[model samples]
Target: MQAYDAQTLVLCALADGPLHGYAVNTAIERLVGTRLGPGSLYGALSRLEAKQLIEPADDAGAQPRQRPVRLTPTGRQVLERELRSMAKVAAAGLASLKVNPA
Candidate 1:
């Protein structure tokens, strides 16, 4: 799918641990205050699975329809790297901006 941003957000959301769809959406909302629609959420999940960035951990005590997902070791590494890149970009952007101090 074309949800690159959503994929990133999903990956970040799963960084904490395994969570199903609703829980994943909740975690993402907590982090970014943006609620992902079902389509976007599922699409991102599918793409990440295809890329091997995420995997089905286990259902365990979850509801019949709830399948929790977790990040693979590679996924964690990729997320960490992406966060570092984002931080650098944010720092550079802030450095380039002119702030007027009173």
Candidate 2:
């Protein structure tokens, strides 16, 4: 749960369902204001797959298509753990802000 790039998180979020890279890129932009290019997108995906955070899914798109992706149970566990850690961090930050008023 160390700080991960926003697109990485966005990718994990979309693993709730299979999605193409374009859909993932748009979601990343919408969710985190990051403009993800092809190299960056696939690089992240490759690393994530290596880490077992996501896996390839079948693509049914009609074009020069790309593989869709979805989360494994391991991925879901990792996401949940990261989210809980983020919540704890946010809570601590909020507490500090309240105490210091800065």
Candidate 3:
């Protein structure tokens, strides 16, 4: 099971598409509305790495020592499953709201 929060999980999932840490952080800020702290960021990175969901890639073309992140097949599968499940829950909620609008 993922130990990270929804934000961390989503960030990791997005990095699967390939992005350096700075870019990842920036993208996350854009998606989430606030910058992530170092402790939480690294902690989530460690957990994702341990789970084999995301891996570090060479940053030859990156800005200086920036390392890129890539998602593993397992990570992709996990994210897909999570997305589907979340969608289902959202659908149910929407259906309910339709019946009882406020």
Candidate 4:
């Protein structure tokens, strides 16, 4: 699995459903406790779009830049796989530290 930062966050934000840029940021903030600036959000969006991980949705009232986006099937699969990998790493780290299971 590839190491991801904002990209993973972005993907995780969209995992629940479709969201426009602003909404995506909101979701990300709620999830990660930080807001992505416009530049960072859009940059991650562009890369995700280019990778075919996400696509615009049929949001008629939205402007081009505000159009909602949903993860593609491939995107969901990739995100799920990545999450599983992350879970494994987290488990290992916790175990190594002798952290009690929640």
TM-score of each: 0.85, 0.76, 0.73, 0.89
In angstroms, give how far residue 7 of model 4 lies from its true place: 1.0
Candidate of highest lDDT: 4
Q: Using TM-score as the measure, which candidate wins?
A: 4
- The regions of model 4 sitting more than 4 angstroms off are 1-4
Estimate the overall C-alpha local distance difference test score of candidate 1: 0.84
Clashing pairs in 3: 16-71
TM-score-wise, the better of 1 and 3 is 1
Better of 2 and 4 by lDDT: 4
Q: How would you encode candidate 4's per-residue C-alpha lDDT over 1-102 as one tens digit per residue? A: 333488888899999999998998899888877888888889999999999999988886788568999999999998999999989998999999999656
Residue 44's lDDT in candidate 1: 88
Clashes (backbone N, CA, C under 3 Å), per candidate, total 0, 0, 1, 0
The list of candidate 1 runs beyond 4 A from truth reads 1-4, 60-65, 98-102
Higher lDDT: candidate 1 or 4? Answer: 4
Which ranges of candidate 2 are over 4 A from the true structure?
1-7, 60-65, 99-102
Angstrom error at residue 63, model 4: 2.1
Consecutive 10-residue window with the lowest summed lDDT within model 4 = 1-10
What tens digits encode model 3's per-residue C-alpha lDDT throughout 28-97?
A: 7676566567776666666777889877776656653276777788887787777788778878898888
Give every collision pair in model 2.
Answer: none
lDDT of 2 by residue, 16-78 (tens): 587766787777767666656677787877777788877777754534226678787888877
